[model samples]
Target: MDREIAYGAIGARLETKLNETGLSRNEQAESLGISRSALATYISLERIPSASTVARAVDRFDIDPRWLLTGDERDRITRDQWVAVLSAFVELKAIMDRLFKDRIGWHQASHDDRMKVYRAGETLYEIGGISALNACANALYEGNPGAQLGAGDMLNHLFNGIGPWRA
Candidate 1:
C-alpha cells in the first residue's frame, strides 16, 4: 500500500477498536501510555503510530497486530470464505457497473465514487454473506426509495449497518 493509504487504514482500524471498547479517549490513551492528543493524531491519520504504540494497543486490547495495520484477518478466513468473497467481488463489480452505467454512465463516474460502492458491497458481504450483498445491489437496481442517493450517501447507509466486529 502507499504510505498514506497504509496510515489511513491503520488509523481507521485504530478508531474502530477504540469505538468498540466504549472507553473514553483519555482512558484509552492512558492505558496505552500516550496523551489524548497523541491518540487523536493517530486516529486522525495525521501521524503514523510507532511500533511501541502498536504493540501496546495489541496487548491492551487483545487486538491482532496484523489486523491493526493491514485490515485483514488472513488466518481467520477459510478457503470457502475466500472463494465467497472473491465471487461476491466479481458479482458486485458487474452489478455496480450496470447500475452506474444506467444512472450516471460508468465511464463518467469518478473512480472514488465507484470504489465507495465496491467497498460498501464488500462490507455488506462480510456482515451477512452474499445474500446481504445482493440485497443491497437489488435495492439499488430496483429503484428503491433510497436508490437515488449518491455513492457517498449509499456508502453511509451500508456502513451504518456494520457492527464493530466487521470493521
Candidate 2:
C-alpha cells in the first residue's frame, strides 16, 4: 500500500477507537499522553502516529496494531464520519480564532507564529480542555504586562520544547 493510504487507514482506525471510547478529544489526548493537535494530525492524516503513540493506543484502547495499520473493510470511515471530522476541524479553527482574537500582534504575526499559537492552544486544551485554553487567552487579554509575559513565555516554551513542563 502507498504510505499515504497506510496513514489514512491508521487514522481511520484511530478515529474508530476514539469513538468507541466515547471520550472527548481532550480526554482522549490526555489518556494517550499526547497533545490534542497530535491526535488531530493523526486523524487528519497529516502525520503518522509515532511508534510510542501507536503502542500507547494499542495498549490503552485494546486495538490490534496490525489492524490499526491496515484496517479492514469494517474500519473504513463513512461519509458521515468524514463530514463529522471535517466539522470538528472547523470548530477547532473557530476556537483557535477566538483564542487569538483581540490579542496584540496576532493580526501582524506571520503564519508560522500563528501556527505556534495554535499548537500552544492545542496543548493547553489537552491539559484542561476548553477552560485551560480560555485561561491562556484571558491571560493574554488582560492588560497586565506581567501576566501576558508569563503566558507568552509558557507558549514559547511549549512550542520550542525548552521548558521544565512537559505539557
Candidate 3:
C-alpha cells in the first residue's frame, strides 16, 4: 500500500472541510502559524498533519478532526490512530489480494494445496489454529471481517503455533 496516497486522501478531505467553511489555505496557514505550503501539503495528505494542527483547523473552522482525518467526522477513531490504521489496512488488503490469487492458483487449488493456502491465509487474518484444519475452520467462521486485524497478529497466527499461550 502506498502510505503517501492515503495521507494525500486525508489532506484532500481536510481541504474540503476548509472550503465548506469558506476558509482558504492561506488564511489557515496564517492563523495556525504553519507555512502555507505545509498547510497545502496537509490539504493534499502528502504529509501526515500533527494532531495539534488538525485540532487548530477544527477549532478554527468549527469542524471535527475525525472528519478531516478520515472523511468521516462521525467515526469514533482518533486522528492519529485512524491515519495509522488506514495505511495498515491498505497494506493488509494487498496481502489479502495475494492470498486470493493463491487460492485460485493451480498448485494451491488441489485438496492439500488449497488447504495450505487457506491455512496461510488464516495467519494473515489472525486466527491462529493448531493445524491446517483448525485454521481453515477459523478462517471460514471468522470470515473476511477478521482480516482487519494487524499484521503482528496475522504473523503470530501464521507462524506461532496456535494462540499466544500455545506459542
TM-score of each: 0.43, 0.40, 0.39
The sequence of per-residue lDDT tens digits that candidate 2 reaches over residues 1-167 is: 21222434567789988899989999999989999998998898776665457657866877754356544333544435433423433443444455446453445556665665555555443333333333343323334545445445444434344232344
lDDT of 2: 0.54
Q: Specify the highest-lDDT model's number.
A: 1
**lDDT to native, each model:** 0.57, 0.54, 0.47
Q: What stretches of model 3 exceed 4 Å from their correct place?
A: 1-5, 73-167
lDDT of 3 by residue, 1-167 (tens): 10112334656776776677666667878877789998877766466565456556656766544445444334444555434433433343455455555654333334654344334544323311122222222223233434423323443444443334335
lDDT of 1 by residue, 10-67 (tens): 6678889888998999999999999999899888877656545765786788666545
Sort by TM-score, top down from the best: 1, 2, 3
TM-score for candidate 1, residues paired by index: 0.43
lDDT of 3: 0.47
Worst 10 residues of 2 by lDDT: 132-141
Cα distance off (Å), candidate 2, residue 37: 1.0
Which pairs clash in the backbone of model 3? Answer: 7-45, 8-45, 11-43
Give stretches of model 2 more than 4 Å off: 1-5, 72-167
lDDT of 1 at 20: 91
